[model samples]
Target chain A: MSAAETTPQRIAGRGAAPQRSLWHVILVRPETMTLVLLVLAVILASQLSPFFLDISYILRSFTLSAEFAIVALVLTMVIIAGEIDLSPAANMALSTCLFAWAQASGVPMPIAIAIGLVAGLAMGALNAFMVIGLQLPSIIVTIGTLTLYRGLAQIIAGDKSIRMPEWFIGIDKVLVFGVPATVAIFVVVSLVLGLILAGTIFGRQIYQIGTNEVAARYAGIRTRRIKLILFLLMGLAAAIAGMLTASRLGSVRYDLGLGGELQMVLMAMLGGTYIFGGRGTILGTFLAAWLLVVVSTGMTVANLLPAIQLTVLGVLLIVAIIATNLIYSRAQR
Target chain B: MNALGRILARRETGIAVMIVLFALAVSLYKPQFLTLNSLRVILLLTPLVMIAAMGQMLVLVARHVDLSIGSMLGLSAMLTGMMFRDLPEIPWGLGFAVSIGIGTLLGLVNGALVTFFRLPSIIVTLGTLNLYRGLTFIVSNARQVDRQFIPADLKGMSQTSPLLGIPWIIFMAFAVALLTYWFAMHTRVGRQIFALGSNPIAAPLRGVKVTQVTLLVFAISGALSGLAGIMYASRWGFVNPSNTGFGFEFQVIAAVVIGGVSINGGVGSVLGVMLGVLLMGCVAAALPLLGIPGTAQSAIYGAVILVALLIDRSVRRQGIARFKAARA
Candidate 1:
């Protein structure tokens, strides 16, 4: 049994594997595909409209989805660890609503922010406990929490939008060396997470856990703890993203970031993250984020209705998953 | 006595008992809840969910889920609504064919993607959920079909009663449920679905047609959602692109789970699901009477789903333990 398990790992470790050409290595990677798609999207957008090639306009547009992109980086890790959290968008709504409501009701700014962050953490902990402690499936568990969190947000905010302090608004307008602050944060988070996923032993363990949980446990990895940490990080990232969104909009409402989970999942899937788990990278998600921004911005620039854009996004999600799955299966050969 | 014990031990009976208990508890606070008028209200509120839950139950029993049911409902209803507005001369009965036909086609698309590409149902349906919703918007130009556009005969389905003052829609919902119960219990393909869901790998070895069964469940789910779509038009007297069936999948899923349909698949009953829908109806009707705001409805649904999941887990564990003891 041990030998059967270790054989795949041994073959995957460079030494026992058959030699492959450099082109095969480069062309077969899902990340490479994502990069190619990114380039293709840029070209397509430019052809659709004359003004699409402006780097500044594209940069400005990137800020709109920067929060989702940041959360997608964390989401990529969670998917790699073979679990999913669909409630993050709802988490964003609830956390932000709490923050806004607290501040509006005469709470201090710092405490309100802390309240939001802690609430996000608690939500994550609940998910972790349900999934890890109770051994419930993450997909369904997250779906349940998604509804709960969104519903809680609705109950709290009750069809009203709460205004943020004037000074707290417009994080997107705050430029960092010619880039929007939100965009800058996305890039930095991507870089940090990318390195952690690619360079750390912890990252390899996550891959192992996703690949085979029993085998990973036998290999002495603390699978539950790792998953718990990932869920907590997901909650934290969602909270931060929520605040960023609140700042950008200058208000908070129950519907804040409504349907944002679709965008986040689309980014991760486009990046070639295997839905079943164990094979994905932050770099892929990073490139996919830009690809999405280009496609949506192009549609917006072309004066297409939002309905058409929604159709395009849905088609892209299905196609991306299919393409990524095919690419992975082929690469295995 | 033995037959009674067996019946009492069934999941359907448990759900029925819960419904009675819940309704009684609610009545303690508001005696009006027990009135026939309130019963009519509860029944009216549940027809759409009941229809959708039957479809969802089949999908769950097949070890798959259809998240796109809501979108399918919206798209079908939007199309039927458009037909009414554009071609007012067409017979009103043709709307059922159009709506159900569109739903079946959309469901087939989901099934094809899942079976052909071997992708997960959850992701595929999630994609189509957006796709269908987008199509609904595109088809309707983001406008709503007004009350005037809906046929008077169709709207009467919700108001006019054939028996006991219950709306025709209520009877129609029960008819669908009875049909589903027969289909699930009596049909060969129905048994095959349970067989396929219970053990997919061994199912092929047992001569079950995997692809066909999967496609069939999704198609059935889609068809039912489509039926519910037209019902939405009748009951509400209008169909809005975004508002028609938004968050509908959650409500159906919550009801199905609470009805004792296991998420792991291959175990459920039509009666349980029907009772579950009734329970949800009771809660919804009770909320306004109990002075709880409407906004709390979604939260309660969410909580109910989680609680149901916990219950499902414990029940399965107990079943396993009992089986072990019997073996010993």
Candidate 2:
């Protein structure tokens, strides 16, 4: 079922055309809030520690969350389409464990990587089939799969970290134009996804589906097919992220990227993506990712406890959603 | 007679049959699985989940989920543990009031966010799950409440049985279930919760105190989880900042869903939930006997949840078809 049926608040078709100023259009957007927050976080973080101002240090820290950030790009699309996938983090662990296990067992590295990608696609297909084919709710379906995938990863790896081949490690260390490869990948992915979300017919249809599925379907939007494709893309992105993580860590474990879902979802929410779906931008998430890195890295540099950082992220998620909801509801009027 | 027959053929019966079949199949593979000791093992594994599932059931029936139950359990248990460790002179019974009280407060925060702000409960709880967990670590300074800090009498609740060799915790879990049954079936507010979940818009129109009922379910859920938190210390005799109540929402959700509580809300039974808890306990107990690694248990739980979802869906479809047919 679509989110509109479950949630009480449903924003219908653009009600009326009220004359709006350019400044209202730009400054009133959730993306603008994200931008403001990014600046605020940077200034605040810099005040917290002298070392926080280092560009290279911040870039290095950005690489740490770059894997999740990359996945968040695709996640933004899925959420816009009015569904969610909580299983990607688990998908990362499972696919990477399979990749690492395959390579360690003497499979060709190329074949091993392919195996990982295909496994990720297959997991995505499973989610799509349950959600699209069986018509199950995405939230609960993904939660079930999340647990299943993580559990399977545990069974496969058994509390052991499978080491990656020497040459395959350190994708984060390869910098181009003073940016880590993973960080660069995150930026490129964000731009491409941002364009797809804003500039493509397909992207507009996703918003339509999220806004009202029955209306979209009646309008011949192929809602199920579009959602299926979105779920598949989510799976593929998660797989790529898994390999990136494995390369960075030089090993694969069942707990790889554990709780990464919270970070990815936090990115989406902080970027002003409405939790109930149908409104958000890739630009918001992109800036939010950097904002997160600055805040977290600042805390780390200042010797703040990780517990406090966790608290801050949690509070940020709640606050961001509340703020985004308020902005969208007001904008609708 | 036909209506009575249909009533007898309920989800609870189906789950009960599955439980028996599963036990018999396992026993065939290992005769020892049928022994009383194996039953004891299964029962022992269920008390914590059983307590939490009742609260989870109410939350689900209210059409809102509380993912933060696990973290609430952790935080409450940690705080209670800290009290025992530092205070030393306080009566052990106070831990119940304190843990449950803290859980109620945290749950009320969740309810407030969802009701007053109109945020979705799932997202709100997901946020608090991390928030409470981080608070637990901050409060405990990342230290575990060691076994020595836990009162011996509390720990003894798990081992010492007052009747029929069943531990006190098991009885406590049953008492909670019975209380939930009474609250859900006999109380007007209980039915109001159902009315609210079945149709939120219609609920307010019907004078169902939307905010009050919503907050009540969450508070009840929190209070029960608090009870489970202290029971966690009783059962395990220690509370680690990171490990206590970790991933507990999954296990409890699995049981509730397997009990045939509809995710769409306003449909559940205490008996079915109790049976679901037992089924999970059986599977957990059977794993070691069957030589399956403990790592596979979570996979089984996940698989069970999905399968249960499918079963619930099909049953719902059939019921809808039958309703249409009868009307025609």
Q: Write the residue-wise lDDT of candidate 1 on A7-102 in tens digits.
A: 788677746557889999888988999899888888888888867788889999999999999999999999999998889999999999998999
Error of 2 at A178 (Å): 2.2
lDDT of 1 by residue, B27-118 (tens): 99899999999888899999999998998999999888889999999999999999999999999999999999999999899988998899
- Docking level of model 2: medium
TM-score of each: 0.97, 0.97
CAPRI quality of model 1: medium
Query: Model 2: per-residue lDDT, tens digit, A1-333?
Result: 334373443434344456899999999999999889888988888888766778898999999999999999889889988898889999999999999999999999999999999999999999999999999888888889999999999999999899998999999999989899999999999989899889999989999998889999999999989998998998899999999999999989999999899999999999988888888999999999999998898888888788878888889889988999999988877
* TM-score of the first chain alone, every candidate: 0.94, 0.94
Worst lDDT run of 10 residues, candidate 1 chain B, spans B197-206
Candidate 2 C-alpha lDDT tens digits along B1-328: 5987877788898999999999999999999999999999999999889988999998889899999999999999999999999999899999999999999999899999999899988788889999999999999999999999999999999999999999999999999999999999899999988888878878887778888988989998898889999999999999999999999999999999999899888899999999999999999999999999999977887898899889989998999999999999
Task: Output the lDDT of residue A301, model 2.
Answer: 81
Q: Residue A290, candidate 1: how far off, in angstroms?
A: 0.6
Report, to 2 decimal places, the DockQ of model 1: 0.56
